[model samples]
Target: MKTKRMNPFKPTAGGEPPLLIGRNRVIRDFEKGLDNGVGAPGRIMLITGARGTGKTVMLTVLGDKARERGWEVLEETASSGLCERLVSELRTKEGLMDKLTIRPSVSFAGASVSLGEAELSPKRMPETLRKAMAARLDILEKRSSGLLISIDEAQAASMEDMIAIATAIQHQIRERRNIAIIFAGLPQMVSDLYNDEVITFLRRARLNVLSDVSLDEVRNAFSQTFADSQMTISDSQISVAADVTKGYPYMIQLVGYYIWDAADIRDSWVVTDEDVKNGIDEAHYDLDNAVCIPELQGLSKTDREYLEAMSQSDGPSATAEVARRMGKSAQYAATYRKRLLDAYVIRETERGEVDFAVPFLREYLRKKS
Candidate 1:
């Protein structure tokens, strides 16, 4: 029997993907805050998840919704030098802040304003940036009903900047009642944000952590995708594919892509269990060859050993255990932990347990070891 061809299921750049299942609750929460007024203390939203868990997608959706509601939105990526760029951008746009009734205390002229002029000349650039931001927000309070700033990959932002931004938003801007900030990034983002001794921004902001999709949701989403293409697949087939992927968004799409293409090659009208099995195998191979191989090429021997040890374990190891296994002291293991986390090799759960954030990563590590 020939199989029916299916549609592609990869992420659509610059557009919403079909079968974007789940995340309704998060959308609603953001909408509720906007409706009630974002200027209320403790109204900001922070979305964190592993890479490819759709943090970017959620942020884009929220930005679209906010724009539809007549709110001014500024989207930027978190980076070491983002604060300076932001100040430069703000200064270049004449009366940009004026539209929202925000007036800059100091203006950028021929070159970007020095972090000093804005009363931000602290030891940390982020601190300086925060003061400058507060000054501008003070002006915005007069013009706009509210302002929303959306930042992606916010964990990359400097500790000083994170603290500065959080402090300004929580203490300085919250009083004015006209601004909201949303930060989205990998799971470590919250830890980085909280590391600032001066501010408890993570505590004050609402957390919206994206998790793996449920089996039922995954089945429905897959079935819906096929149905949208005027094709059909068996429930058992969908369930099997979901199990293989554990409902990770990227894996789901990867497997779906193979299944659809396989059906096209067979000229079949319906997907079967066998096709799902083949697709799962193909997806695993593709991930190993495309993602894992390239990342492994750059790792040092110690890094590889650390990853192997982590993969064999179920959760975060005790500092002492990891140190003993790696033949290093607890202090040395802690350093490796930070390096791995920074490279996205591992993640810490809410309860402080560490693990391979992506299931596929464990498989890759096992094969390598």
Candidate 2:
């Protein structure tokens, strides 16, 4: 007899893993905010992080928590017609606001005929989203429940749509209606939104930066996740796997996924150090092909060169030193520094030093160069 094997790790972007490590505090705080009622600060929050940092997963967890609190959760992308779509969603649900009516007609022969059920329409359906949302919130308020709007990849959302959504939310807040909006996106998107005067309300929204997990956290996640599936991996194996993953959320899953598959579950049902080593290689290959290339393709030539210069360093590179290495003036480097930081390809470790935000990005750059 052979045992069936199942991989517990999810490495795909935005995919929720079986266990989400290093984000408990934020999740707890958001839930507490919801319990505090309509004006809770955490109710309107923005999550910012580099790619592979689990921003989307955090949003998913938060939305789940909101639903548990009896809130209607609507997941949306910031695309063309976003506001119109949001307005349409509210208008579509207008039926819930009005009472259902069944009108009976009396015939000349004295027999009564009943028409099929129909919703009682309001005297005027609001033409604007702000008005429609207000009307909809009025109905939802009566039910003592709230609405949670979660936006993912918020950077791609149009400015006009962003304003409309924010305006509607602001109105709901002033009216004391229960509503919450959470947004998740890259670090640059968060910065741009904060800079937009039209949507300054987001500046006050709770901003949470999704940071890397600790090696210890990664180790525990790997060990416990594997054990949950009725398999045991040696401590050495887990340590190697975690170190290879460098505590980035996506890499943690990628490393675990590949390692789990390499373990020969049907035969040995154990993950050895060799399996971990091989899995690391496979994971890195996949990451380069899937994530790194696409991310780099989106950047400007200066961005790539700036990163290439930084890759020469063994550890966190000083901003001034990188500028010198690139044979450019400090001001030129500073410009690109901010650009890369905003793009999330690199992060500042100290006041004047930066390192690749994503695990293994430096290595990938080095190999490509």
Candidate 3:
């Protein structure tokens, strides 16, 4: 039997999986918008999720889909200086207009001597950033190719740059110019962005909040991915793997990756239940260190304390209960609650109830506390 060449699973955050388990509707809507061209609702999209919820991967999918439809895709993070970077990209494309050159030559004794070269005059780019973007769009418009701008880590982008991009896109939309902008970020940051007065227009953009995937989708992905990778496992084993992931996109990949490696270690062509059992511990450790720890480290002392209190609950905890355990006033606890909710560290299941959104986070916190 031929050994499988390598592990097919990609467990790292932001890495594309062999099979995207969920998000079918998102992909379909985006494609429909691209087909409709300007003024389509899908053209302007905001993807919000927690850190490991595949926001970046979704942006990648959006860009890939646009490119497949013969559109120009420009991807960038919404970091500081986004406006300047976009302006620079537009200027570069503007320079491409003067690519042709002509050399004046004189023939003497059957030999041609070049005197000087006259090049195509460069087009003047607009001084303003918005106008410069418009000028670039005009060029693409002539060719019947639309532009798709995708921004990842959008929460980090400065308000000024966000406004510039929003205004430029608004101008293009008003003109019916073919352009679209997609943004992905953490839920709280995205909410903050939408609440900003300068980019109020983005309030109308289509919002996609990525949540836990369905178990059926996860199971199907595991079966198909493993079969393709030349590994076989029982349906029960697949179920175990899926349940282990708790429907988190990143955890699904992590469990699959480690399980595959476990099979490899045993020199077995087929994956067994024992391999999966061993892999779970390893996957859990890696997930905590890679995702959970760093997330906690970024929080304030009070926020961490709030989470530690919440961890005592088996399921969703009441805000009042958590406050009582922390020995703080209800208002004081409310502040940290809101902070954690905004940060996507916890989610509200119903009125007065909150729970850890990150799978297995409660267990990790319990051990730490």
Q: Which candidate has the highest TM-score of all? A: 3
User: Which model scores highest in lDDT?
Assistant: 3
Which stretches of model 3 miss by more than 4 angstroms?
A: 96-127
How large is the C-alpha RMSD of every model relative to the true structure?
5.7, 7.8, 8.2
Candidate 2 lDDT score relative to the true structure: 0.80
Give all TM-scores, in the order shown: 0.76, 0.85, 0.88
In model 1, the runs with Cα more than 4 Å from the true position are: 1-8, 12-15, 40-42, 92-145, 264-269, 272-278, 289-298, 312-344, 347-354
Candidate 2's residue-wise lDDT over 36-90, tens digit each?
9878899999998888888888888898898887788878877776765666677
The lDDT for every candidate, in the order shown, is 0.70, 0.80, 0.83
Ten residues in sequence with the least summed lDDT for candidate 1: 94-103
Candidate 1 lDDT score relative to the true structure: 0.70
Ranking of candidates on TM-score, top first = 3, 2, 1
The local distance difference test score of model 3 is 0.83
Clashing pairs in 3: none
